[model samples]
Target: MPRIRSSPNSSLPNPNAPPITTTTISTTTIHTNTTVDPAAAAVAGFFNNLLNKIPLPRWAIYTIFACGALLILLICLCICKKCCCKGKKKKRQKKTDEKINLNGVNGKTTTALVQPDVTDVDYGATKEKQRGKFLYSLEYKAAQSELIVGIKQANSLKAMDLGGTSDPYVKVYILPDKSRTCETKVFRNTLNPVFNEQFTFQISKSSLLNSTAVMQVFDFNRFSKHNIIGELRLQLCDVDWNHVIEEWQDLAGPAKFEEENLGEICFSLRYVPTAGKLTVVILEAKNMKSMDIGGSSDPYVKVQLALDKRKWKKRKTSIKKKTLNPYYNESFTFDVSFEQIQRVNLVISVWDHDAMTRNDAMGKIFLGCDASGNQLRHWADMLSNPRRPVAQWHNLLSAEQVNSTLTLKKKIPLASKLPF
Candidate 1:
C-alpha cells in the first residue's frame, strides 16, 4: 500500500493561509526538505512508481529523468516568454492612454480623438501625438454667394513651448483659392477657450461647390515662429448647403500639400545690385480667393522683409475693391545689400480689408521657400540673372502644416559672386 506522510514539526508557509498541496515521498514531505519544483518532483515519483511496476533498468530510468528535466525547462521558458509579451503589451497601452488624456491649462483634464500609432511613417520624425479640438458650423448661401463658418470653441490644446501651455489661434481658408484666409483671435494660455466667432467668404456657387475648407490650429509665440498644432479639412460641397451644420470635430494631422492648389499669385522682381535695392512689384493675381461681404473682395498686398528686427518693411498696397483677381501693380523697395539678400526672406501676403475686424490673410509667398514657396522661384531667378526684371506666376499655398502646402524648389544660395 502507498503510504502518505506529513512532518508534524514543520510550520506553515503562512500561518494565516490555508494548507497548500505538497508532494509526499514515502515517509518524508518532499516539498519542505528540498527546493525542487513540486511538479518536477511529482513527475520523478511517478516515473519511479512506473519503473517499479514494470521493473525497468537503471539506464532507462535515468533517460526518463533527463526527458522530464528538459520538459520542465521548456515549460519555464514558455512562461517567461508569455510574461515578457504581456509586459510589453501593457506598456504600449499605457503610452496610448497618455496620448488621449490632455491636462487643461487651468489644471482640468482634457481629451482627444482616437489615438493613432505615431511612427516615422506617421508624422515623419517626432512621436508627438496629434492633439487639440474645436466646435464649428458651416453654411453656404447660394443667393448671397457666400460660405459662412462659425468657430465656437477649442479644448485641451497641446503646449508648444517650455511655458507649458499654448496661445491658441485658428486660421481658416477655402482651398484651391488662397486669395482669402479667415482667422480667429489668439486665446492666451488657456487650452479650453471660447471663440464664438463667425466668418464669411465671398465665393460663387459654382466655385463654392468644389471648394474645401482648411482650418489650421497654431500656437502663437511672440519671440519665435508660430507653430502649427493640427488642421481640419472638409469639402465645402459635401455639407448640406441649405442649412447650418454644426459638429465637434477633432483636429487631424494637416495634409495640405496635395492638390489644395489654392490658386496663384503673379508678381515681378527687379534687383539692382549696384544700388543695393530690391524692388518687388505686385502686378495682379489670377484665380484668387474672394473675402468680402460684397460678392467680391477688397484685396491688398502686405510685404515684409524678414530682417534683423523682423520689423515690418512698413509697406502695403491700397485695398482694391470687389475682385478675386485684384490688380495691384504696386511697387515696394527694400534697401538691402547683396550679402543681406542671401540671409533675408521676403513675405508678400495679400489680405482682405475688414473695417470691423482684423484684416484676414488671403494668401502668401516668400522669397525663400523656407517660409512659403509661392515666390521663391521669382526671387531665385532675379538673383540668378543680375540687373534684370524676373516675372513669374506663383501658386498660392495655405502655409506650413503636417505637410507643406506648396512644393518648392530648394532655395539655392545666390551665385557666390555678387552682381555688383
Candidate 2:
C-alpha cells in the first residue's frame, strides 16, 4: 500500500503550484463521499487561506472576519443614507426654483379695466362695485401720437349744486400728465349739459396701457371757484379699441359725492373748408337756471362767432321751458375762410330766457386757444386736415367774457398795486 496524506484546503498557496484540495475518507467497502459547489468552494477556500496566513489564533481570525463584514455593512448603510439625503435636497431645490418663477415683485401687470364706460346700465353684468353707466369710445393712432375719444351723452344724473340743478361739465385728461386735457362746457344752472364734443389727446399708444383717463365734473361759478361735483376715471387697456362701445355709467365723486348729478348736454359741430363755413350744432341744454319768480326759466344757447376784431356775429337756439336742461339740436354756421379759421373765434353763451326782462347770460365760453387752449388746436387740425368731422366737449367760461376775463381778473386786483 502506498503511503497517502491529505492536506487541508485552508493552507496558503505555494509559488508556481496548482490549487490544492483536501478530503477525509474511510475505506470500509461502504464508502461515504461529499462534494461542494465549485464557486462556493472557491470563495470559502479564499477566505480560509487568507485566515490561515494570519499570525492570530483561529478564534481571533474568525472574530476579525466577522468585524470586517459588519464594518462593510455599516459603510453601505452610510452611503445609502447619504444618497437618500442628497435626493431630498435636490427635490427641495427644484421646488424653491418653481416658487420664485410663479411669484415675483416685478412680475405683476394691470389687466382689469380700472374704470369703464358708463351707459344705459344693464344691471345684469354689474358687480357691487359697478355703480354708474359706462359708455365711451377710444381710437389709438400710434403714428399720429393722438387718442380720439367720443362721448355721446349721459342720461339720469343727480343735481349737486342747486336745489334740483347741477351745472354739469366733463373735464378729461390722461393721468401722469395731469396738465388737463379738455373740459366740457357747463350747462348752466341745469343738471345736464349737452356736449356732443369730440376730444383728442397727444399721447403715444405704447403709453396708454400705463395711462388712465381721469374725468371730473364741476359746477360753473362766475363769483366762486368751481366745485368738484364728481369724477369718472377709466383705464385704457380695458377698452376694446376695435369697436365703439356705449353704455350708461354712474359718475363717481370725490369722498363727498353728496347727491345725484344734475344732468348732461348734447351738441355737435361741422367745418366745411371749401365752403368756408363753421357750423355748430347746439343739440340741447337741461336743468337751466330759473330767471322766473317761481317756475323753471326758459333756456337757450346764445351762439356767437367773432368775425373780425371787435365784431362777433350772434345766433340763438329756440327757448326751452320749465325743465332745467333744454334740448335744441339747432345748427349755426359762421363764415370762416381757411385763413380766417385761426383768426375767428367761436363763443357760446347759455342764457336764461325771460319773457318780461332781458335775457340773463348764464354761462359763456370762448372756444379757441385764447380761452380753452384746445379750441385753437381743434380749429387748426380741422382746417389743415379738413373733411373729417372733429368734435369735443369744451368747458364753458366762468366769466361772461372768456377772452378778456382771464387777463381782466388778473389785472383787476393788480390795478391797486400798479403805482398807487
Candidate 3:
C-alpha cells in the first residue's frame, strides 16, 4: 500500500534558520588527598642516596646490611649469655661456702682436701696475717727428773674453718727427744679455746740444756688431714727451772731449711700369711741433714709399699725437730695377699719439713726380692720368720740414684722360692 505523497516535515530547508546545532560541554574536576610521613621520607631518601653513591646493586647492599645487623645481634646474645653464666657460678660458690660454714657451726665435720673457694694467694695472705697467741706454764723439778707443763688457754687464734672459727687442739713435745708427745682435747668452733690441761715429761737435769719445748696449735679434721694454725718454740736453757713460769707466746711459722748431710734409716718388717697383715716399723734415723739456721733439723719418716711396683701405699711419722740422730718408733700395717707379697717393694725415705717452701727429701732406701746385699738379707730374714718382726739398718742413697734404681723392672720370684 504505497501512495506517493509530498511530506513537508521531511524537507531539509531549515538550514539558515538556525542550524542551531547541539553544543555539549562536560566539566569534571578530580581532587587527590594524600599525606607523606617525614621520617619515612627521610629514611627512604637516605637509603636512596646511599644506594646512588655505592657501586653495588641494591640487592647486594641490602644483603650486606642485613648480615651486619644479624651479626651484631648474635654478638650481643653471646655477651649476655656469658654474663649470665658468670653470675650463676658466683652464686653457686657463695651458696656452697655458706653451707659449709653452717655445718661447721653445728659441730658437723666436712671432709675436703682444701677450700675450693679460696685461691692460693688469698689463703697465703690470710694465713700470714692471723697467727694467734697461747698461754702456757712450765716447771722443772731437778730432784725427780720431771718436767710439768700446763696449757691454760689460747686467744685470737687463726680461723681455719669455713665458719670463721677453729676446732683447736694443742700438741706439746720436747725437741731432740720426741719419744714422749702429748695433746689436749679438741675444742670445737672457737677462736679462743680454753684447755686447762697438764702433762709431765721425764727428763734428767743434764738433758734440759740441750732440749727445747715445742708447742703447736692445730685445727682438727676427722676424715682428712689436720691444719696447723701456728707453733711456739722455747729453748729450755733460757728458762729458769726453779719456779713455775707462765707466759703468753706469740705463734710463728716454721723455720726455713738449710743444707746439711745425707742420712741413714733403720726399720723392721713382719708378715703374716694367715691374717694378710704386713707390719713395718720405722725405727730411727741418723746423720740427718740440718734444715734450720741453728744447725738442727726437723726430720720425718715416710714408709711406702709398692704392689706390682706401680701401685704404692704410703704412711708417715711425726716430725722430730732439732736433732741429727732422731728416733721414731712409729709403726704402719698393710693388708697384703699371699700372691701379692712376692711382688712387693718397701721404700723408706726421710724428709725435712719447711713451712714456707716445699719439703726437702734428704735420703731414701728400697728393698725387694730383686735387691742385693744387706737389703736382700733383711728381706730374706723377714720372709723366713713369719709373724716375727725382723729389723736392720740401711744406708740411705741419694734421691737421683734411688729414683733411677727403683725404675728397674725385675721378674717376680715364684711363691715357693720367695725366701719362705
Candidate 4:
C-alpha cells in the first residue's frame, strides 16, 4: 500500500478513493451591438500611459486626479458666486439711491447733486428752481452749542456780467439777527464755483427753534454793486439734529435783496495821539444811486465829526458830476484830542448835488467806538495802529436805516444838514 502514492500535481486520476463523478457548470455571455468610441479609447490610452510613467502607486495617482478635479470645481463655483453677489449689490445700491432721491426721509426730497426722477419734479412750482442749485452742510453740535455750516459749491448760476460767465461768492447769515455773517472768496469767470468755506454760529439748543439760516449767492462786480443771484433760507426747526444735514437745494429768487445793494465806500483813516490830529482820506465811492434824470448823478462826499451824537465839525469834497463811481482821493484833517476820540463818531454822507432843488442823500455810514459790525471794527483798527493809516471798504445804508441804527441826541436842523 505504500508503494503507489499519487501526487497532487499528477495528471492521471487517483484510484485510491471511491469512483468520483464530475459535473460541468455552463455559463452564457450575451453579445450586443454596442459601439466603441475611438476618441474615448485614445484619451483613456493617453492617460493610462501618463499614469504609468509616474513613479507613484496607482492609488496615489487616482487620489491626486480626484483632488485636482474637485479643487477646479470649487474655484469655478466661488468665482460664479462672487460675480453674482457683486451684481446684486450694485443693483441694490442703485435702487436705494433712487428711492432716497425720490422720497426722502422727511417727505421732502433731499436730492443732492444727483437729479431726481422726472416724475418727482413739480411742474407747478416756480421756475426759479431751474436757475441753479447749491450744495451745503449743516451740523448741530450739542456739546458746544454751535451750528457748523459748510458751503461746498454751486452749479449753473446765472451770469450777470457781459461775458457768458459769473464771478460768484457766497454769503452766510444767521437771521433774524444778521450780525453773524461769513463771506466766501470771489471766484472769477465761472458759472460753477466751489467755495470750500466753513462758518460757525453760537446757538443754544433753546434758540434752535427760532433760528433761520440764509445763504445768498451773489455775482461779484468790480465796478458796480454785487447782484444777488439767488438765495436759500432754511429754518433750523425743520432739521433733524440726530445727524448732520447735507443736501443740494434749488436756489430761489431773492425777495428783499435790493436793500443789500445800498453800495460801498472805501477810505483810509489815520489818527495821531500826540498831535491830536485825525486824518480821513476819501479814496473812492462806487455804485452810488442815480438821483438825477438820465440815470446819472452829481455826487459829492460830506464828512462830519460827531461828538456825543451831535455834529461838531464838518467838511465837504468837490462834486464829481455825472459819475456813479467818483474818485475823490481827497484828504481832510480834524482836531481830535485822544480823550475825545473815544466818544467821537465819523459820519460819512453821500449827497447828489442839485442846482434847482435840495440835495438828496444817496447813502450814509458812521464809524465810532459804539458803532456795530464793520464800523466798530474799522474804528478799532484805526485806534489800534496809531499814526498808521488803515483803509477799509464800508457798505452804505439808506437814511432811514442809518437813523434807526444810531443813538442820536436830537435831529439836526435842515440848515446844518445841507451838503454844500
Instruction: List TM-score per model, in order.
Output: 0.36, 0.36, 0.37, 0.45
Give the winner by TM-score: 3 or 4: 4
Per-residue lDDT of model 1, residues 1-420, tens digit only: 486766445574668666666666665445656567999999999977877886778888789889999999999999999999999999999987877554323343232223333442566433334376778989878789888888888787777767778887787877786556555767778778788888788889888878888878877653334577877889877777667899887777767584454456777788889888988888887666766766677788877776432433558888887788788888888898877777666766778898889988776666652432224435666888877877776555555521133233333334573333
Candidate 4 lDDT: 0.83
Deviation from native of the Cα of residue 282 in model 2, angstroms: 1.0
lDDT per residue, candidate 4, 307-349, as tens digits? 8787778999999999999999999999999988988999898
Q: Runs in model 2 with CA error above 4 Å?
A: 1-265, 307-309, 373-385, 401-403, 406-420
**Model 4 weakest lDDT span, ten residues long:** 1-10
- Model 2, 231-255: lDDT tens digits are 6777888887676655556667554
lDDT of each: 0.70, 0.63, 0.79, 0.83
Per-residue lDDT, model 2, residue 236, is 82
Q: Which stretches of candidate 3 lie over 4 Å from their true place?
A: 1-129, 256-420
Please give the lDDT score at residue 180 for candidate 3.
51
- Better by lDDT, candidate 3 or 2: 3
lDDT of 1: 0.70
Per-residue C-alpha lDDT of model 3 across residues 138-237, encoded as one tens digit per residue: 9998888999889999999999999899998887777775555556777879999999888788889889889988888888764334678988888999
